[model samples]
Target: MDQNSAKEGKGLSIIAYITIIGVLIAFFMNQEKKNSFTFFHIRQSLGLWLMYFIFGYVISGFDSWMLTYSFWIFFAVLFLYGLLGAISGKANSIPILGDFFQKLFKSLGN
Candidate 1:
């Protein structure tokens, strides 16, 4: 998609990834006008945030530099991947977990 068409849903797409509150706001924002691009991002961001919490709890016991950095880098990359896609107006799923997220949140985003 070109920049112009991408611009339409970029705002809500980025907003959905900002925070939990932002996700809810973006959800409602796109309720009236459903933008597939924004919805795709919302699903990805929601999946990322949910995984962040799940991993946080699971990794709390493992105190190691390798684990620490790996965890941070993994999520960071995922976040950046989605954010950049949104900025560029692309509907690319994050990477590994993206497709699953899209499927999981399909009902809501649609």
Candidate 2:
């Protein structure tokens, strides 16, 4: 995408990483323009949030602080990574599951 497109989508893109609600907000807001950059981040954030909830449920069963802390840190780093990319107007995916997310949500911005 062009720089202008990136610039236009930057706000909603960053918002997409804020929370699951942000993802929904960005998604509906971007519906008219169908901004690819915003949609890209939306997919990433959506997947991350879903993973967080799913894993959080399982992690809650564990009593070890180490396990809990690790889970928190892992998701935090991933969220931050995606957030920074959106802030910088880049669409670099989060590591590991990024490609999977793109493929999984391929129909999102279509």
Candidate 1 local distance difference test against the native: 0.86
Candidate 1 local lDDT, 1-110, one digit each (tens): 44554688899999988887888898899998787788888899999999998997888789887987899899999998888888878989888999999889999855
Misplaced by over 4 Å in model 1 are: 1-5
Q: What are the clashing pairs of model 1?
A: none
RMSD of each: 1.8, 0.6
| TM-scores for candidates 1 onward, in order | 0.90, 0.97
Quote the lDDT for 62 in model 1. 92
Candidate 1, position 58, lDDT: 86
lDDT of each residue in 1-110, candidate 2, tens digit only: 87888999999999999989999999999999998889999999999999999999999999999999999999999999999999999989899999999999899999
